[model samples]
Target: MEEIIDQNEHVGIVADDLTSAADGAGAFLTYGYQPLVRRQRQASVGAPVVAVDTGSRLMEEADAMRATGQAIASLAGCRHLYKTIDSTLRGHIRAEIAAAFKASGRPRLVIAPAFPTAGRTTVDGIQLLHGVPVAQTAYGHDPVHPARASLIADLIAPDLGRMATVPVSATDSDIGKHIAGASIIVVDAHSQILLNRRIAEITKHGPALWVGSPGMAEALAAVVGQSPDRQTFTPPNAPRHILVLVGSANHLSHAQYEALAATGASVADRAEGIAKTASVACIHAPRARTADPSKVLCALVDEADIALSRQWYDAIVATGGETMSALMERLSIHTFTLVKELEPGFPLGCARLSNGRPILLAMKAGGFGSVMTLCNATNAILQMGRKST
Candidate 1:
C-alpha cells in the first residue's frame, strides 16, 4: 500500500505479512509505521518486546513491519476494548494471555481496532487489559480487501494528506444477490490482490460479504466474485448521517443527546422539520416539537448532523417512510428501513432490488411515538470502512 500511494514524504503501505521488507518497501524510518516482522529482525533478541496488544487482529507496526511479515500489524492508542465473560477455565486461559499484553494493573478499555473478525486473539487481550467492550468495525466484505479498511478510513479522515487519493468508480456485475439497477465495481477500486493478501493475514476464513447501497457496494461484489457462496461477513460502515431524525414525543437520553452533539447531527420533529437553524448553541434534550410545515421540515433537515460527522451528508432528513423512501430513491443509495413490527431500540434491515443495485434502508416500526430524537453517530469506534463511490 505504501508503494501504491507513495508521495515524496509520505508513503501508504498495507502489507499482508508483518515484516519490514514484506512489501518491497525499504526499512522503516524513525517515524513510519512498521510491521512486527521488521521489528523482530532489527530488535535485539534479549530486548523487552514491549508489545501493545490492541486486542485486535494486530497489524504489524510501521516500525516493526517491512514488506514481509509472519503477522500483520495495527496502530496504537486506539480507544476501545472488549470484556469477555467465559467459564472459570476460560477465565484462567484469558488471565495468562492478558499477562503478556499488559502489566499487573487492569487496562482501562480493551481496544479492538476493527479487524477481519475482530479476532479471538483481541478478545483474549481484553482479559489481559481492563474492561473494554470489543470494539468492532462496521465495514463489510470489500474486494479491495486488506487495504480497503484503511482506504475507507483515509476517505473519512479530516485530512486527505496521507497519500494520493484516487476515487475509483466502477460498475458492478449484474449477476448476484444485489438490488436492481445497482452496479458492481471493477478495476483497481476493488483490489482483489489486496483483499486476498489480507485474508491470508487474518485466518483461513474465505471472506466477508457487505450488501447495502447498491451503487458502491456492488462495486465490491463485482470484485469478490458473483458467487452466492458465503463465509464470514464483511461489515459496512454506518453511513455518516448528515441529518438528525427526531420524534416529537421521542426524547434523547442524556448520553444519547451528548453523542448526537459529539457527532454534530441536527434535531428535527417527527413531521421531519428543523426546529433550530443557523447556529446551534446547545445540544440539550429539545422539547418534543412537531413538524408544522414542509419548508420548516426542509430547513431542519438541511441543518441536521451531517456537519457533525467526518462528512457533510448530502442532506439532513427528518423521518417518515415517504420521505425516507423518496430520499433513498433519489440518492440511488440504500436508506435504512425499520420494520413496522420491530420494537423500539436499534433496528436493522435492508431493501434489495433485482441484481442492479441494493437500496440500503433504515426504518423503525411499531408504536414509534412522534416524540423521539434521531441522530447519526459512528455506531462503534473509528472503524468506519466505506464511503459512497
Candidate 2:
C-alpha cells in the first residue's frame, strides 16, 4: 500500500491526455491556485494543484490501467484526488477509473461527467452534447476511442462493481441516500448550479474518488476554498510569430482552420517548407479521412518538428491532444506552467524545452471551440506580443 498523506490543501488531478490535463487544471485558476500540468508521474512539491497527464486514452486497456495507477500512486501526497474524464465518454474510461479508484485507496468513486458551459450535460445517467445523445454526435465518429454508448452506466458497467445513478434534482438528503452502499455513484447534472450542488453533497458524504469534466473541477475548486494568496508568475514574452498545428480531423477543427485562414493567416497542408510570410501559419492534416490515425499523428509531429527546426516561433497552438502530446514529446517538454485560459477549455501555458528555453503554448481539444476560436487565439497572441513590447 502506498503511504497516503492527509493534506486537504493540495489537489491532484489525473487526466488521460495533455489537453484534458490542462483543461482540468485551468478551473483552479479562479481560486488563485497555480496549477502545473506535468506530462509524467513526477512529483511537483509545493504546487497548489498538480495535474498529471497519463496519455493513456488511446492505449491498450491494461496499459491504460497501469499508467493511470502509476500516476495516481505518484500523487499520494495529495489528500484530494480527481480523475478527469472526457465529457462525451471517450477513452478507456473503465480501466482508468478503476485504476484511480484502486490506486487512490478511495472507498467509492463518484462520477459526474457534465460541462454545461460546453453544452455537455448528464440526465438520467445518459450523457448529452447540446441536448442530443453523445452517440449521435460527431464524437461518436471519432477517429480513435469513439463513444460506443451514451449512457454513462452502460459505458462502465460490470467492471467498476455496484453502481447507482443520482439525478440532478436530488436534494442533499436524496444524494446521501444514493451514495450509501454504492461503490460507484454516477450523478446527473444539466447545469453548473446543479453540478456544484451535487459535488458539494457527494464530497460532504466522505473522501471518495471524484471523476468528471472541467465543470466538476471548477466545483471542486470552490468546495476546496481559495489559496491564502494568489501566486503570480510572469509569462514569457509574446511571440511575434505563432504556429498553429491542427492535428484533429474533427469538423469543428476544420472549420476553425478555415476561419483562421480566411483571416489572412498562411495555410499549408504540410508543416514542412512553409514560408514565414504571415504572422500566423497553420499546418493541418488532410481533410480526407485516414485509415491509420497513428500515421497521420506521426506525420504531423514530424512536419511540425521540421518546421520548428527551420524557424523559431514565439508561441505554438496545438489543437488536438494527441498532436500536442506528440509535439511536446518531440521537443522534450514534460512540464507546463499554466498562465491562464485563452478560452474556456483552451489553456495557455509556458513550457520549457530541454535547453531551458521557455515558449508559449496554447492547447485546445479538436472538437471544442467555435469556428472563430483559432482566429481569436491568434489575435490574442498578437495582442500579448504588443503588450510585452
Candidate 3:
C-alpha cells in the first residue's frame, strides 16, 4: 500500500474469475503497485493497478464476452491493458480476449497462456499440463468449460478468425515479422525463459494489448521497468486460530482440502458444524457435484456458530472465487487490504471491522496450488499475522 500511495499512473487487468484477477494484480504488487480487485465494472480511482473480474467463466459465451467488454470499458485511461487468461484452455478464452481487445481500443493483441512454474504451457500451439495435454489431465473433468482439446488455436478457434501464430521457438526476426502484420498473435511458450523472451519482443512492438496468465504479467511488469522489493515484514505476535473452507468441487481443490485435513485439523462437514474443542477447523462443503454450491456456502456461513466480533479465528482460508465472494458478502465485508500473495495463485488479504480490526483472509483459485497449498497457506497466514502485529 505504501508503494503506490503517492502514484497516479494506472495499469489495468481484466480477468474471467476472481482468483485470476487477483493473480494478475498480485504480479504488480511485487513491483510497488497498490493492487486492488474490483468486483464491479467501474473506473479505478486511486489504485495504481486494478484487476477486474468479469465473473463470466460459467456464463454463456455471448454473455461472457459482454461482461468482459464492460470490464475493459472501465479501464479506458490505463496506460497498459492486460487480459488475463486461464493457463489451461478453460472458459471462453477466445471470446473474452476478443472482447478485451475490442473494448480496450488497442491496435494489436498478443496472447500467451503459459505459466511454466505451474506446469501449464503452450507448445506447438497446444496447451500442456505437466507435459501432458490439458484435455488428458484432471482439468478435463471440470464441470464448467472442460477442456476438450490441447491445440491452443483450436481451443479458441471459434472466435479467433485470422490471427497469426508465432511459436516461442521462432527467431526474434521471425516473430517481429508476424507481429508487424497481424492484429492478434498467439505464441507457443513451453518455459519461462521462452515466454520472457517473447514478452521482450512483444514489448518492442509498442503499446499493444498484452494477454496471458500471471507469468506473462510478471514479464510485462519487468519490461515496463518495475522491479520487486524482496523484504519480509516482521508481524507482531497475535493469538491466531484459523478456519479452512472448501467450497469448490474441483478435484484439485478437494485433494488440497483433504491434504490440509490430514494434517490433524478438526474436520467438520457443514452439517456437523465446528467442534467445541477444536482450535483449527476445516469446514468441508458437501462432495456431491450436482448440489448447488452457492447454497452450500451460504448455509455454512449462516450456520457458523463462531463469533466474528470476538475474532476467534486468526484467519479464514477459502478456496474458489464464488465461495470467497459469498463468504465476504455474508460477513458484510466490502473492502480488504491487499497483503502479499502466499504463492503464485494464492492471494492473502485482510478484511477489517469498522474499528479497523483485521480479519485475515487467504484464498486461491479452484484449480491452483499443490496438495498441501491449503495447509501451507494457513501456516503462512498465521506467521504473517503474528509478524505484522
Q: What does candidate 3's lDDT look like per residue over 1-389, in tens digits?
A: 11112123457788887778878887766765556676644334456677777778868999998988887767756777788988877888777777877877778778888899888888777789999999899788876568776776664444434678887658987877777667777888877888888888877777778888888887777665553433333332363678778877778888887887688776767525555445567776777675466577776665443534333676778888877777776666655545688887787766664556667777787767789888888777667656667
Ranking by TM-score: 2, 3, 1
> What is each predicted model's overall lDDT from 0 to 1?
0.24, 0.84, 0.72
Poorly placed runs, candidate 1 (over 4 Å): 1-243, 247-249, 252-255, 262-296, 302-323, 329-345, 348-377, 381-389
Question: How would you encode candidate 2's per-residue C-alpha lDDT over 95-189 as one tens digit per residue?
Answer: 78878888888888889899998899999999999999998898899766798789887756576678998986678788878878888899898
lDDT of 1 by residue, 92-172 (tens): 112222322232122221112212211211121121112222222321231111222122221122221121111223123
Who is ahead in TM-score, 1 or 2?
A: 2
Q: Identify the candidate with maximal lDDT.
A: 2
**Between the candidate structures 1 and 2, which one is better when assessed by lDDT?**
2
Number of the top TM-score candidate: 2
Off by over 4 Å in 3: 1-8, 41-43, 136-138, 155-162, 227-239, 250-264, 275-279, 304-311, 353-356
Candidates sorted on lDDT, descending: 2, 3, 1
